[model samples]
Target: MLSVRDLWRRHRRKVFISVGVLGSGYLLYKLYGAHRRRLDALERELAIQRESEELMKVQLSQIMQAHFENIQTISDVMTLPHAMHNLSCRVAEELDLSQLLERLLQGKGQPSTLTQSEKLNLWERLKILSFTRMALSVWATTMLSLYTKVQVNILGRHLYIDTARRFESSSTTESGDLVDKEDQQKFLGTVDFLCQHGMPPLISDMEAATQEALKGKQLSHFFNSTALHETIMQILIIFMSQGSPHSWIKYVMPEDSATSRIDDPAPSDVTEFEQLMTEARAVLLSAEFGSILEICMKVVVNAVVEQMGAKFRGGSIAMGLPLARVLPQVAQMCPLLLEEPSKNQFIRIIKCIPEVEPFFTRLYANMPSAY
Candidate 1:
């Protein structure tokens, strides 16, 4: 070692270099530690986010599955077979053709402002009219029943989709009771409308059509199955065409005090309900629906014709006509009465709407096997 002053002057540069190196190393270590800590925090946050996403997925899946089950249950609840059986029974009771015929014959000579041939013709025409009216009643009932089933299926699916979407976006979980209460009320309202408003008016319309078609026709003219079929088909087509699809909304979703609230400005489901109604109207106007309606009309018309032919063949009535010729003509008229190009377009469009395809399948499956 040299003297103190001499040593300090010589080592000062080395000391300053060593100190600077140590300080820089310490800073680098601290910065590395901080980066590692930040990365760890980020990893933890990412794990939490992934867990949350998985939870959300499970919840959404559960919600959708529940909705699907609900839709199936709804379909079972609105069974068309049960409804049709009930309707047929009620109609048979209300329109007893045998009793009506007996009554008509009982008053045969009671006083008429017409000749004997005229009275006989009048009685025959009335008999035919009664049969036509009965057939129309059955047709109207079948149509309305089919409509109710379709409406319920479409609206029920719509309601489930809407509820699922809502539940997905919301943080709060769904309450089963609340959803059931709302859905039940809406569906019940549809039933009420069908019974109280829908069937009565539709039946009345069909009855009016029968009256208009057979107003002045004689019994022989009425027996011209080709002309009769064409006339009835035209009336049916006009009846179907007269109303806008929107006119059916009331029957599908009847208003009820239960669905409304006095405190709230508007129901949360109003917009969704309207959207569903729009979709339903679209389905109604779709070609698929038209094809179904056409098929149903054919079924009803054929059944009526078959029944009439059977009655005629069995000589259930005293008409003097030969059954062999009349029955052949009637059988020939059993083919579809109307065909329109627009119905094809509707069918094509309906096939593309996958969401509604299930409904169509269900409807077609539920139709009478003869169809």
Candidate 2:
């Protein structure tokens, strides 16, 4: 009887302990629920604030754009001194160009003066952006100066080339790949932005502004100069990256042809690249851009090669020539480059390249078409 009573008491004690633990857990769960609800509420509020901030940014941009437009309309066509005075008044009235450009690009009210960190960040972005993005940005900047009747200067051109060189230097991988995965995404994003927000504006509105500005400044031949030529070459480097298998260029200049033997069977990637060239050529031919592209190409294929020969003095004479393809390959890709005297001249130049000539000679030996 004593043993039975002891067992019963122990069982009763155990039951009380179980109940106590369950009660504590229940209270803790209720407290957790209350805290979770508060956290969720805070997150919702934060999201709402972000949306409001973006809305305000959009509104501010619209207002500033109109303000600049008005300044341009009122100031342009005025005599140089009068124009200068009007711009000065606008500046004094709190419409500084740098500050306005800051608002345009960053949604900030600060001046366009860049901190070292900001410049480093901008340089990082330059590695991935296409020439189109760079060009559009340049165009916007030029327009802003023009709108304010500011003088055209070498500062813009110098910065552009320096950035491009730095970008190109950093663009290549240790393994000789031109672009990596991260760069591809950035490049695609830049292209997307250019097509969506950039080109349309430049083609429609900014084009007129550019022409008027150049004409007004009596620099109508500005676009035809070495400034634009060098810019075009830098832009072409973006495409050159596509030609390499290990580079992101293959993806951008993707191959999209069916496989076969001799007819279209020049490797899948090569076929794809050739197709891209064909499509691009057709577009260039059909558009007004053709004339400019033609001029740029003439400058590039001829003068660029000569410049490279001068710059790189070591045993590898072609070291400076990044787009140094075999003459046969370039011709196959774009036959327009093979037109008569130019083609003959290009062949002569290729033959004279010390580092490249031996390989070209061997190629010519095996394939008559290489000649």
Candidate 2, after superposition: displacement of residue 341 in Å? 42
lDDT of 2 by residue, 1-371 (tens): 99989998879888888999999999999999999999999999999988966865565456444543443343333322242233223223321133333433562344365665675444323222222332223322222222122111111222233334544465322342222334322322222222233334333332233333222222122222244334435444333223332232122122332132333424555543243233322222232222333333444345434443453444222432222121112212222222222233333343343443343224223211222
TM-score of model number 2: 0.24
Q: After superposition, how far is residue 334 of candidate 1 from its true place, in Å?
A: 14
- Those runs of model 2 whose alpha carbons end farther than 4 Å from true positions after fitting are 1-8, 77-148, 151-371
TM-score of each: 0.55, 0.24
- Candidate 1, residues 49-142, lDDT tens digits: the string is 8998788778766765676556545543543333444444544444345554455555664545456775676555454445344444434444
Estimate every model's Cα lDDT from 0 to 1.
0.50, 0.35
Q: List all candidate RMSDs to the true structure.
A: 9.6, 29.5
In the predicted model 2, the residue pairs found to clash are 242-249, 255-272
Clashing pairs in 1: 287-346, 287-347
